[model samples]
Target: MAAFIIRRLLQSVLVLGFMSLLVFVGVYAIGNPVDILISPQADQADMARAIAALGLDQPLWQQYLIFLKQALSGDLGRSFAYSIPAIQLILERIPATLELALTATGIAVLLGIPLGLWAGLAPDSWPGKLIMTGSILGFSLPTFWVGLMLIMLFAVELGWLPSGGRGPTTELFGIPVSFLSWEGIRHLILPAVNLALFKLALIIRLARAGTREALLQDYVKFARAKGLSEARVVCVHVAKNIMIPIVTVIGLEFGSVIAFAVVTESIFAWPGMGKLLIDSINVLDRPVIVAYLMVIVSLFILINLAVDIIYSLLDPRVRIGEAKT
Candidate 1:
């Protein structure tokens, strides 16, 4: 296990090193930041000084080497746009993004699993058909459009919830979270639900497929032959076996939710990293953009590592396979 973990960690380092190069080059290639920073009326000396101050005067390869060195020491550099540490700016918005992502994932698991299990168990029934239909529609609809419709119904028409924003927050465990308070939860619902729709649909399909496959396995037949109740057989034998894939999907999708919440955050005006990213892009803020991408990449790697560990734990065959490798 230690060797497995060390191997994975080494692989993660290589992935991040490659990612940093791509992100740095890609961000640098996107028009000079000096264009946006200085006035057109500024003379040659002003331009030269500004370029030198930003180290934009240096060769691209030299600048990247400098960036790579600083990044190794945990310095992402100051944001030209905000004049703050890039990591600090990203961290400040993490709680909001985390809260939203986790809430949506919670909703997906709570509702999706059971519905999918039911659908898988009785594929010919009306309720199963309904679930299948809903899942299909859930996959079909765009997140932004769904968010708008939800706001129209829940906020504009019913007036039960606020249209957007994180709402008032109180610190819980040193992290400011909205769901701690009732009002905050209300404000959180629309965006969370919007963000959850696609993920929920995906979970439903994955769970259903896993359940169907598990039900046909010999262990399930053995459980049934022993006169175990239908619910017990399904819940214990079937659910346990199927959970390996479900857990894998959940772990990986949680990272995706954080990375892809930009549309939902924009629609709802939620003050998360997604919103921050959009504002930075508009001004061509390279530090924030690159920093955000790096953070997202790091999160993905960590999540994948966790998923691998969990997957191996849940299925002994996987552990054995890794040992052989």
Candidate 2:
């Protein structure tokens, strides 16, 4: 297990190094730094000063080494447009995005798993058909469009919730809170649901398929023949076996949710890293862009690592180098 973990960590480092190289190359390929340094009214001395300030006068290798050093030291530098520390800006907005992603993921798992189990256990039944239909619609619909429709129905037409923003300005239970208020919750509901829709569909489909496969296995047949209760056969016997694949999907989806929050956040005017990244990109803010990219890549790698560890835990055969059949 320790060897496996260490190996994975080393691979993660290599992946990060390669990812950094790709980002640097891509950003540099977009345009020359000279364009940014030279304005219409700038003179020779002004251009030279700007070039020196940005370290554009240095060789490409030297510039890359300096950037790498600063990044390693957790100094992501200042945003070219905002004139603020890139790391600081990202840290400030991270909480909202994390909250949204977690909330949506939780909703997806909670709703998707039970529905999936039901559908899988009763494959040809009406409830199974309904679950399948819902999953299909969810997978087919775009998140942004779903969000818009939700807002239109729940916020505008019904007038039950605010169309956008975090929450109201008030106290709840003697705590200074807004999102806890009814209006705030109403505003959050649609966006959260929209975010969860696709994830829910994926989970349900994976779960149903896994359950079906598990139910057909010889071990499940043996359990049934042994006269174990149907619930025990399904929940304890089948569900446990189905978890490995479901865990993989959940982890991947969770990682995607972090980076993919941009569009949803934009639609709802939610203050998050997604909005910050978009804003930085619009203004060609290198520091902010780089920082956002690093955060996202790191999160993705970490999630996959966690998934690997989880797989080992769920199936001891994985830890022992036994091939998965």
Q: Number of the top candidate by lDDT? A: 1
| Residue runs of model 1 more than 4 Å from their true location after superposition | 320-325
RMSD of 2: 3.5
**TM-score to native of every candidate shown:** 0.96, 0.89
- Can you give the lDDT of residue 65 in candidate 2? 84
Report the number of the highest-TM-score candidate: 1
| Candidate 2, lDDT over the whole model | 0.83
For model 2, residues 29-134, the per-residue Cα lDDT tens digits are 6665456635779988898888788777888778778989998888887777666889989987876787678889999999988889999999899999999999
Candidate 1 lDDT at 101 equals 99
Model 1, position 60: C-alpha lDDT score:
89
